[model samples]
Target: MSDLTFENVTVRYGTRRRGLTAVDGADLTVPAGTVVGLVGESGSGKSTLARAAVGLTPVTGGRILLGGDPVHRIGGGGNPRPLQMVFQDPYSSLDPRMTIGDSIAEAVPRRVVRGSVARRAEVTRLLELVHLPTDGADRYPAELSGGQRQRVALARALAGRPEVVIADEITSALDVSIQGTVLNLVQDLRRQIGLSMLFISHNLAVVRYVSDIIAVMYLGRIVEYGSVDEVLGDPQHPYTRELLAAAPRPGGALLAVPDDDPALLAVADTEPADPHHPPPGCRFHPRCPVGPLVHPDRQVCLTSEPSATPHRHRAACHFAATTDSATLP
Candidate 1:
C-alpha cells in the first residue's frame, strides 16, 4: 500500500506580478490503494495541486509525502518512481515524431535499461498491460484515436511501475464514448495494480464515478471534502451546493437552488480575490450566498482564513458550525 499526503501545500507563481497562489494551504491524504477525486471548475487550482504532487511544479510551501517519505527529498539516491503523472492532453504530452514504443521506453532511466530490442520488448509489455494492441508500438501518436493515445500515455506512466498516478483532467477532452472506456481502464488498472490515484476534473459526474473521496476546490482552496457518497449525496459547503446546482442533471431538470440572484455571476467572473492579499476575512464571503445571514461572523470568513477541521462532513464556511446538511438545497 502506498499512501500520499499533502500537508498545507501551497503553489505560487510570479515575482513582481501578484504571485497567484494557485493552490492554497491544501491538505489531503490519498490512502494506500484509494482513489481521491480533486474536483473544481477551471482555474480552481486542481491541476496545479496535481503538478505539485508529481514534482512537475515546485511547491512554494508545505510537504508532499509518499508512504511517509518526502517527495522532494527522495531524489537523493532513492527510487522516486513511486509517483507519476498522466497529463490532460495526450497529444501534446507525446512527441509527434516518436513511435509509441520509444515514448514509453523514455520513462526509464538510461542506466537501468538500455538497447533498442530490450526497450521494444518492454514497451510491448506495457501496451498489453494498458490493454492496447502491440501493433500500436509502431505507430506515432497521431495515428491513434484519442482513447488509444490516452492508453499509450497510461502505458508510459505505468512503465515506471508507479504506485500513485496523478491524472489531471485526463478524460475531459475525450468523446463521451471514449471517456467511459478510459475511465473503466483506469478503474481496472487500480484494482489490478493497487494503484492510488488523484483524479482531477471539473466534471462532477465523472469525478463521482472515479473517486472514493472527493475534494472540492474554489479559487485556490479546498472548500469541501469527504467520502464521495457523503460529500456528493449530502454536500454541506455553500460553494459545493452552488457547484452541484450548476451541474447538469440526468432528467434535464435543475436541482434545488440555494439562491438565484444574478449578482452572484458578477462575483464569479472577477479574479478570485488574491489569496495572499485576500480580503480581510472569509475568502469566499464575497460570493457566498449565505454571506448576509452570518455577516458579522462572516467577517471571519473574509478576514481570517478558515481551517479544515474534520466533522461528520467538512466545509470551510463560517456557518459550518451551525449549518445542517438537511437544510441545504
Candidate 2:
C-alpha cells in the first residue's frame, strides 16, 4: 500500500511581474486503496497540483511524500514507480507515430522485459488488462477511438506498476456515454489492483460517483475537504454551496443562475486583493454571497486572509466556525 501526502505544497509559475500562484499552500492525503477527488473550476490549479505529484511539474515549495518517503523534496530526486499521471488529452499524450504496443512497451523498464518478444507479450497483457483487444496493439493512436486512446494511456501508466495514479480530467474529452464506461473501468481497476487515485475533475456528478473523498479548490486553494457525502451532499463553504447550486440536477433544473454581469465576472476574475496588500481579513469577501452574514465585521473580511480550520468536516471560511448546517439548495 502506498500513502501519498502533500504538506503545504505551493506551486508558482513565471517571474514576479507575470507570475501566478497556481497552487497555494495546499495539503492533502491519499491513503492507499482509496480514491480522492480534487474538484474545482478552471484555473483552480487542480491540474497543476496533479502534475506536480508525478514529477511532471516543478514544485516551487513544500513536499510530496509517497508511503512516508518524500518524492518532491526541495533538493531530492523522485521515486518513479510510486506516483504516475494520466493527462487530460489522451490523443496528444500518446505518440501519433508510435504503435500503441510500442508506447505501452516503452513504459516497461528495459531490465524487467529485456527481449523484444518478452516486451511484446507484456504489452499484449497490459492491453487486455485495460480492456482493449490484444491485437489493438498493432494500431497507431490515431486509429483508436477517444475512449480507446484513453485506455491506452491508462495501460501506459499501469506498465510502471504505480500505486498512485493521478488522473487529470481523463474523461472530459469523451462523449457522455463513453465517459461512463471509462469511469467504470477506472473504478474496476482500482478494486482489482488496489490502486490509490487522485481524480481531478470539474464535474461534480462524476466526482461524486468516483470519489470516496472530495476536496474543493477555488483560486488555487482548497475551501473544503471531506467525504463525498459530507462535502457534496452537504457543502459547508459558501463557494461550495454556490458551486452545487450552479450544477445541473437530475430533474433538469439548474442549480443556480451563473452571474452574467460582465463587470462582476471581470471583477471575480481579477487577482484577489493581496493578503499583504489588502485591509485586514478574508480574501473571499468580494464575491462571497454569504460574506455579510458570515462576517459581520465586513471590514475584516474584506482585509484579512482566512486559515483552514475544522468544522463539520473542514472549511477555510470564517462562517465555518459558526455554521452547523450544510446548505444544499
Candidate 3:
C-alpha cells in the first residue's frame, strides 16, 4: 500500500493571469491503507482534485506523489494500473457494445493477461469480489441493473490491480436501497485488500460511515480536516457547522444554528462564490457566518487568507481557533 499525497496542489483554467482557480493549494493525503473522505458542497472543487490525481485534469502548481514517487498523466506515457478511478455514473463509464468480461479483461494487469483462460479467470474472480454473479460477465451492460453496473465498474477498477482507488461518488447513482451494499463492498475491499482510497461524496453521513479521516472543503480550499468523530461531533469551522445544521437530522431534530442564520446554506438567498472573481482574503468570506457580515470587527477575513499545511487540522477560517461549534449561534 502506498501513500497518496497532494503537495499544495492547485488547478486553474483559461489563463494564468486571469484564469479561474478550481483547487487552491490543497494539502491532503490518503494514507497507506485507509480511506479519506472528502466532503463539500457542489462547486467546492472536490472532483477537480480527484481528476488531477488520475491525470484526467492538469494542475497549475504542486505535485501529486504516490508513495513519494511523482505521479504522471495516465495516458501520457504513464501506466494507469497503479492509480485508478471509479467515476460517478457507472452506466456511462461502461461500454455498452462490449461484454462485461471483455471490459474487465481490458484493465487486467499485463502479467495476468497471458491467455483467454487467465483473463476469464481474473474477470470471474473480480466479479465475485464485488458480489456479482460470475455468469454476468458474459452479458452486456444494458442487461444489468444500475447497482450491478456500478459493481462492474468497481470490478473493472479492481481489475487494474491498483494500489490506490479513487471512488468518486460511486454510490450516488444507485437507489437508496442499494447504496449500503456498495458501501459495504468498498469497506470489504479495503479490509480484504488493504486498498487505500479517496472517497468523495456530498453526504456527510456516508462519509462518516466509511472514512477514517474527513476533510471539509469550501470554495477552492480545505476549510476543516480531522478524524470523522472530531470533525462531525465537534466541528471547528463554520462551514462544517453550517453543513451539519443544514443536513437533515434524524427523527426530525435540527442541529443548533451556528452564530448566524444559514446564510451559507441558504444558497438561494446568497450569490454563489465564483472561482473567476474570488474575493480577497478568504474566498468564502462573503458567505461566512461569522465574517464581517455578522461582525464588522472581524475584518481580517477580508484582508488575509488562512494558511494550511499537511498533517495538521486546517480550520482555515481566521476565527476557528477561538470559536466553538456549539457557541456559533
Candidate 4:
C-alpha cells in the first residue's frame, strides 16, 4: 500500500529562537489510490505540508510516513523514494538549458539510466504517458506554453513511477480553458495508474472537481476534514463555509455573497494569523464570526484550541455540531 501518513507534523523555518512555524501539529493521511485535496488561503501551509510529504522541507516534530516507514528524519533510508512533487510554477521548476527529454530523464533512477538509448526510450514513454507529443521532448521550457510546461512537469514526476504525487496548484498558472484540460489529464492519469495524490489549491471549485476527500486548512491547521460532499456541501467550520461562499457557481461567475453579510465581511477583512507568532488558543478564533459574536457557548474558542471532534465529520471547533453553513450570516 502507498498510504502517506503525517502524524502531528510540524514544519518550522530558520532557528527555533527566531523562526516561523509554517505548519503546526497537522495530522493527515492520503490513503492509497485516493485523491485528498487540501484547500486553504495563500499562507495556510498547504504547500508546506505537500513539500514535507516529499522531503522538500524539514519536519521539526512528529513523523511523516510513506507506507509505514519514517521518511521525515534525514538519512532514513529504509523507504524507497516513493513520492514526487509537481510544482505550481512549471517554468521555474524546469531548467532553461536542458531539453524536456533530458529533464525528465534526470528523474529516472540511476540503475535505469545505463545508456542513452534506454534514457531516450524512457523519456518517450513518459511523454506519451503525460499526453505530450514525442517531438515535444526536444523543446526547451521557454519554447512551451504554460499548459505544455505543466504537462512536462507531470511527465517528469511520473518518470519516478511515484506511489504518491504531490500536486501543488499545477493548474493554477494556466488559463481557465487549459485548466480544465489539465485537470482532465490528471484525473485520467490517476484512474489509469491508480495513483494516490495530495492535490493542493486555493481554489475550492478546482479542489472539489478533483478530490475524493477535502481538508480545509486555516492558518497552519486543518480546521475541517471529510469526504468532498460532506465538507463542501455542508461545511461545519466557518472558514469552510466562507470558502464555499466565495467559490464560483454555475451561471454565476462568482458567488455574490451579500455585501452586508457579517460573516463574509469579517472573513474578508481579517488577515491570516502571522505564521511566526500565531494567536494564542485557536488561531482562527479572533476572526471567527461564530465564536463569541454569534454564540456564547463558543466563547471557549478564544481560550482553548479545539480538538478534531468527530460528528458528521472531523472538525476542530467547539460548536461545530451546532453550526451550519446555511445559517451563517
Question: Who wins the lDDT comparison?
Answer: 3
Candidates 1 and 2 compared by lDDT, better number: 2
Q: What is the lDDT of residue 323 in candidate 1?
A: 47
Task: Give candidate 1 regions above 4 Å deviation.
Answer: 75-80, 109-119, 258-277, 293-297, 324-329
Ten consecutive residues with minimal summed lDDT in candidate 4? 72-81
Candidate 2 residue-wise lDDT, 190-284, digit = tens: 88888789999999999999999999887777889899998877777777776786688888786543478342364456554453233345555
Write down the worst ten-residue block by lDDT for model 2: 72-81
Error of 3 at 277 (Å): 0.7
Q: What is the lDDT of residue 28 in candidate 2?
A: 87
* Candidate 4: residue pairs that collide: none
* Cα TM-score per model: 0.88, 0.87, 0.92, 0.91
Q: How does residue 171 of candidate 1 score in lDDT?
A: 94
Question: Measured by TM-score, how close is model 1 to the native structure?
Answer: 0.88
CA lDDT of every candidate: 0.79, 0.80, 0.84, 0.83
lDDT of 4 by residue, 148-210 (tens): 999999988888767888999998888989999889988998878887899999988789889
Off by over 4 Å in 4: 72-80, 112-114, 253-271, 327-329
Encode model 1's per-residue lDDT on 1-329: one tens digit a residue. 66899988989998737577888788888888889999877778888898888778999999999888897665323233777889988879899999998899988545545787887888888888889989867889899998899889998988776768899989988999999999999889877887789999888889988889999897778888899988888886777877787788878766654465443554455455555566655677776766643344445565577776667467887676554446333
Name the lDDT value of residue 158 in candidate 4.
81
Clashes in model 3: which pairs?
258-328, 258-329, 259-328, 259-329
lDDT over C-alpha atoms for residue 238 of model 3: 74
Error of 1 at 275 (Å): 6.0
